[model samples]
Target: DPPNAHIEVSDDGQGIADQRVDGRYGLAIMAERAERIRGRLEIRPRHPHGTTVAVVLGPAGRRDSV
Candidate 1:
C-alpha cells in the first residue's frame, strides 16, 4: 500500500552486544528516521546468529508478510 512500507537489516556476524546499541551513532540515526516517517523500529537477535532490524509502517504495523 502507498501509505505503508518496511525496511529490514540483518547480519550473520557475532551480533550486537548489549551496550553497543546504546551509544551507537548510526543506529540512533536510523531509529530517528523511522520515527520521523511514523514507523516502528525493532532490533532483535536472529534465531541462531546475528541481529535483525525491522521497520514497519501503516496502521498498527499490521501486514501479511513481505
Candidate 2:
C-alpha cells in the first residue's frame, strides 16, 4: 500500500450537526471497517463548514509460502 491515502466525503447542504457527530451509525461503521482492515479512520471539521472523514490503510504483512 501507499505511504498515505486520503478519502474525503462531504456535503455542503445541512452539514452534520455537532451533536450527531458521535451518534451517527455510519461513522461507527466506518471505524469498524478500518479496524477490520488494520487501518484507522479520522474525522474532522472541514473548512468553512462540513465534516471530513479520512481513512488510511497500512501496508499488509507478507505471508511466508509453505
Candidate 3:
C-alpha cells in the first residue's frame, strides 16, 4: 500500500536573519535522505512570519518476492 507523509517545520524567532548562512547543513542532510527514499523537500517563507520547510515521502512501489 502507498502512503503519504508530510513534515513541516516553522519558527518565528528571527525570521531567517540576513547574517546567517552557516546553518544549512541540516537541509542538505534532509535532501540526501529524501533522495534515498525517493522523496522531495520544499522550502518557502511563511506569510507574516518565518520560513517553512516541508518534506514529503512518496510511496515505494510494490515488489515481488524473489
Would you estimate the TM-scores of all the predictions?
Answer: 0.69, 0.61, 0.62
Clashing pairs in 2: none
Across 1-66, the per-residue lDDT of candidate 2 in tens digits comes to 483445667655545666765455987888977777666788877778777777766666222221
In candidate 1, what residue range of length 10 has the lowest lDDT sum?
A: 57-66
Clash number for every model? 0, 0, 0
Model 3 Cα lDDT, one tens digit per residue, 1-66: 444667789876546554536756776787777666666778777878888888776676222221
Candidate 3 segments exceeding 4 Å error: 1-3, 17-24, 61-66
lDDT of 2 at 39: 69
Give one digit per residue, the lDDT tens place, for model 1 in 1-66.
544676788999888878865555987887877777677688999979999998878665544442
Order of all candidates by TM-score, from best down to worst? 1, 3, 2
Q: Tell me the TM-score of model 3.
A: 0.62
Compare candidates 2 and 3 on TM-score and give the better one: 3
Local distance difference test, per candidate? 0.76, 0.66, 0.67
User: Highest lDDT among the candidates is held by which one?
Assistant: 1
Model 2, residue 58: C-alpha shift (Å)? 1.4
